[model samples]
Target: MNVAGARENVGSLVVHQSGIQCFNCKEFEHFAKECRKPKRVKDSAYHKEKMLLCKQAEQGVPLQAEQYDWLADTDEDIDEHELEAHYSYMGKIQEVPTADTCTNSEPLE
Candidate 1:
């Protein structure tokens, strides 16, 4: 084996410094563990999976048999009041105002 050729071969090999990667934004430099960015809000698919899990559990399915718990894997800590406010806002946007909900008495002239 030629020693000079071996040195050239080793020099050609490029090495990259591996740092933390964020799963939320799929970016490097910052890790998902220490990520300060807003949590990726769960989409419809997430809710669908949760609903399926609930249905399965209600039917006496073995939840422990699963290798991973998708719901429990999240690192986000949801405040009870914040969750309630979110649901309350959603309710306000979704609820249709009926005659009972209307408190205005006099008609606009």
Candidate 2:
């Protein structure tokens, strides 16, 4: 209970949460650093440039179409779609052959 020495107790810092931390939500296994959601960095010009390039590509692509479709879908549905695509892409690495897991591989191939 000594207030004088409290600053010295670095080990007494309390951890309030654990588990995958969502970057967008900002809460533990997942940090904003590991977030799949697109994030803009305030101090980095390189990130701004990358974002501009991505924006340009989105303007040229069917990003609106996909976003509109996804907006109508549930969060779980969207996550399932993204996770499936992610896993399928990972499964296709040249160093390894995985069982045919993805139904839509044309665009990727």
Estimated TM-score for each candidate? 0.30, 0.20
RMSD in Å for candidate 2, one decimal? 16.1
Taking the tens digit of each residue's C-alpha lDDT, what string does model 2 give over 17-76? 243344333443344445576653322343233344455566775443323332233344
With a 3 Å backbone cut-off (N, CA, C), the pairs that clash in candidate 2 are 19-28, 19-29, 20-29, 20-30, 21-30
Q: What are the Cα lDDT values of the candidates? A: 0.51, 0.42
lDDT of 2 at 73: 34
Q: How many pairs collide in each candidate, listed in order?
A: 0, 5
lDDT of 2 at 102: 53
Question: Candidate 1 on 23-59: residue-level lDDT in tens?
Answer: 4455664444456887656544444455566667888
Among these predictions, the greatest lDDT belongs to 1
Q: What is every candidate's alpha-carbon RMSD to the true fold?
A: 14.5, 16.1
Highest-TM-score candidate = 1
Per-residue error for 5 in candidate 2, Å, reads 19
